[model samples]
Target: MDTLQFLIDGFAVALAPQNLMFALFGAFIGTLIGALPGLGPANGVAILIPLAFTLGLPADTAMILLTAVYAGAMYGGRISSILLNIPGDEPAMMTCLDGYPMAQKGKAAEALALSAVASFMGGLIGTIGLILLAPVLAKFALTFGPAEYFALFMLAFATLGGITGKNPMKTVVAATLGIMISTVGIDNTGVQRYTFGILKLYEGVDFILAIVGLFAISELLLFIEERAGAGRKLIQVGKLLLRPRDILHVLPTTLRGGSLGFIAGVLPGAGASLGSFISYTLEKQYLGKKGHFGEGDPRGVAAPEAGNNGASSGALVPMLTLGVPGSGTTAVLLAMLISLNITPGPLMFTQNADIVWGVIAALLIGNLLLLVLNIPLVGFFVKLLSVPPMFLLPMVTMIAFVGIYSISHSTFDLYFMIGFGVAGYLLRKLEMPLVPIILGLLLGPEMEKNLGHALVISDGDWSVLWGTPLAASLWLVAGLGLILPYIVGPILRRRMRAAITEDAVSD
Candidate 1:
C-alpha cells in the first residue's frame, strides 16, 4: 500500500471516539505535568502507563495514549521554561535560558506563542520524516550487529556531554554513578550483583521512581528554599498572536532547528535535550549578533522549541525501527510494548501496521490539538505561576508518591524514591547535571549486553568492535564528539561572551 493510503486508514483508527478521548486525556494530563516545575514527558509517560493498562486498554490504544502524552509533554515543557526561570525538563533547559529573558522583558505572550508555533512546525517536519524515512531506516538497521550498535551508543554518549552542567568532569562522574546503579540487577548470565538479600532488589531500582525523585522531588525542595521574599515580575499578556514580521524572522531558524532535531533524534541516545542544546548553541553563534539572542529574541524561543519537538518525534524512529530507544521516555514505551507482547523492530511495521500507522496519525492530530489548546488557553497556564509554592509542592509530592505506589504497590519503592530525591537535591547543589545520570542508568545494561555479545562473537578479540567500516565511522564520530567539546567549547564561550558584551554596550 502507498504511504498516503496507509495514513488515511491510520487516521480512521486514531479518530475512533474512544481513542480520541484517550488521546485528549493523555495530552491534557501531559501538559499539566510538563508545565509543572520538575516533571516532564518521561515522568508523565511513566506515571500513566500503569493506569492505562489498569483501565484495560488494548495494547494499541494504550500505546497511542502514551505517545500522545509524550508529544504533549514535549510541547508543554516550554510553558514553565518561558514563564519561569525553571526548566520543565532537561530539553527545556535551553528554552529557559532565552525564554525567561523574554518573559522578563514583558514578552511572555510572544515567547509562548512562538514556542507553540515552532513546536508544531518541528513536530510536523519530524512526522513527515517518520513517514518517509522509517521504512528505509528500519531496513538499514537490520544490518547492524552488536559491535555496530555499541559504536552507535558510544557516539550518543559522547554527544551528550554538550548538554552537561558546566563541569564536564562532574558530568562524567554522575554518569558513572548511574551506570553503577544500573548494575544492581541480576546479569544476563543469571548471577546476582547487588540485590543485598532484598527480594525486590533482584529487579533493580525502577527508573520512574528515580526520575520523579530526581526532577520532581528535588524541585520541590528547591522551591521551598527559594520561596522567600523574592518574587517574579508577572506581566499581563497583551497579545496572543504572532506578528507576520516576527514569523518571517523566525521561519528559517525554526526550519533549521527542526531539521537538526530530527537528525539527532534518529541517532540512538542523542535525544531531544541534546537536540535543543545543539540548536541553542548554534543559534547563539549565528544569530546572536543580529537577533540579540538570550535577551528575549523571538528566534531564541523558536529554536529550542522546534528542536525539542522535532527530536521527540525523531526518537521514535529508533524505537519503532531498531527496538532501541533513543531516550528515557522511549525506553519506558519500549517496556510497555514488551509487556503488551508486541515487540518493536523492523518486523513491527509489517506485522503491526495498524499500531504503527495509528501512532503516526495520532501524533499528527495531537500536535494540532496541542497547538489549539496551548494558544487560547495560555493565560490559564500562566495563572499557574500564582499558585503558592507550599501548596503546589505538597500536591506535587503527593502525586509522585501516588504514581510510584500505583506501579508496584510497594513501600520499598517509595523509600527508594525518597532516597533518590535526596541524592538528586545534593547533585543539584553540587552543580552536577542529572540527565547523564538518567541516561547512564537507562543505557548501561543494554550497552553491557551488546558488549558481551560482540566479545562472544569475536572470541574475545577487542578489535571486533572497530572492524567494520560502519563501526569504524561511528567510533571516529564518538571520539570527535568527546574531544572536540573541550577544544571548541572554550573558544565558543569566549566569542559568545564577547558578542553579548558588545551588544550590551551597544544597547
Candidate 2:
C-alpha cells in the first residue's frame, strides 16, 4: 500500500512539463547515439553528462534525463544490428545473428518492429522489478555494518573481472590503478599522500573530468582513428508494420528473456551483455533446432532484445539500493548521483525517495516513448549510419570542452581532461577494460572508509574482516566470484563465439 502511494508521488514528480521535455530529448539523442555502431549506452550517457550539468538540472530531473537516455540507447542498439550486419554495441551482437539475416530476407521491418516490442516488454518488466526489489534490498542493507560493507565492496571488485572483460589480470591492474588514483587527495588524518604540492591535487581527480575523458574523449580519439562510417550502406526498412501473429509468437520468449535478464541484472557483476547472451543461448537450446533458432528466427531477435533491455533496468537495482553498479553505464550513473551530492544505498531510499521514485517513473515513461518513436523513426535512425565521423566528432569534442569549462571555469581541468582522454585511448588500445577503473575510482574511497571503521571497532584485529557470519558469507561469495570465471567463462564464450561463427558462415 505504501509502495503504491510512493509510486503515485513519483509520477507526480516525473510528469512535470520540464522533466517530460528532457526525457523526450534524452530519448531522441540516446537512440541517435546508440544507432551509430560502437557508441552504446555508456558513451551515450557520458557524452551528455556535461549537458545536464550545464543546464543545472536538479538531482531528480538530471537523473530522469540520463535514465531516459540509457533506456533509449538499449532500444536503439537493435537498429544497426538489424539493418547493418554490424552491432551497435556488445549486447546487440546477439541481435545481429538473426536481425541481419532477416533484413536480407526482406523482413527488415518485421524484425525491427518485433524487436522494439520485445525491448519494450523487457524494459517494462525490469522497471516493475526495480520498483518492487529496490526498497526490499535497501531495507535489508540497513542491517549491514562496516565489516559487511567492506566485504560487499570486495565482492564487487572480485566479480567485476568476469563480467566486464575477458581477462581478470588486466582487470586487477586497472582496478589497482584506480585505487592508487583515489589515494591522491588528503587522508582523513589531514596528511596529503600524493598531492605533490599542486593545489587542485588536494581535491583529487574530479569524477566528472575522469568520466568525460575516459568515455567521451577517449571515444572521440578512437572514432578519429577508425575514420568511422567511411562507406556503410543501410538496408531498406520496408513498410514499418508488424503482423499480430508475429507479436503473439514471440510473447512467451520475450517474457522468459525479460525475466532472465532482470535476474541477471539483479546479480552483482552480471550485466546486460551476459543477460542477452544467456537468454538467447538458453532459448535456442530450449527450442532445439525446431524453432529455427539461428537463421533469421524472430525468436532470436526478440529474446536478446528483451534480455538486454531487461538487464538495463535490472542494473539500476544495485546502484540504488547497494551503491554498487551492476554494469558500466550504471557505473557512470552512480558517478552522476555522487557528483550531485546524493549518496546511494540504504539511506538513499529514505533521504532521496523523490529522486529514486521520480527516476523510476521516468523510466516507465521513457520506455513507452521509445516504443512509440522506434518504429516510425527507425528509417531516420538508419540514415544516421551514413553520417560522417568528422562532423560528429567535432561536435562531441566541443560539448566536452565547453561543458567542463562552464563547470569549473578552469583551464587546468580542460588540460587534465585531455590527458585522461589520451591515457584512456592508450588503455583501450592495450585491451585493458575501462569499467573496472571507473568502479575502482567510485568504490575505493567507500571501501577504505568501511575498512577503517571496521578496524577501529576491532582494535586493529585483521580477523575482524571475516569474523562475522554475514561478513564471512560475503567473503565466500567474493572467493567464488574470483574462481568461477575460470570454470564457467570459457564454456560460455566458446558457445557464443561458435554461434556467431556459424551465423557468419550461413550468411
Query: Highest TM-score among the candidates is held by which one?
Result: 2
- TM-scores of the candidates are 0.82, 0.98
Any runs in candidate 2 off by more than 4 Å, and if so which? 229-231
Name the 10 consecutive residues with the lowest summed lDDT in model 1: 226-235
Root-mean-square deviation of every model: 4.0, 1.1
Compare the candidates by lDDT and give the number of the best one: 2
lDDT by residue (71-172, candidate 1, tens digit) is 888988898888767788878877876787788778888899999899999998888888888888877877889999888767756755554525678868
lDDT (0-100) at residue 147 of candidate 2?
Answer: 95
Model 2 C-alpha lDDT per residue in residues 1-507, reported as the tens digit of each score: 878888998999999999999999999999998888888999999988988988889998999999999999999999989998888898999999899889999999999999999999999999999999988999999999999999999999988866675688898999889888888889888989899899999987798899999999998899888866564777888888888898999999999999999998888888898889988998998999678866999999999999999999999999999998999999999999999999999999899999999999999999999999998988888887888887778888888888888888999999999999999999999998888888988899899999999999999998999999999999999999888876787777788899999988876
TM-score of model 2 vs. true structure: 0.98
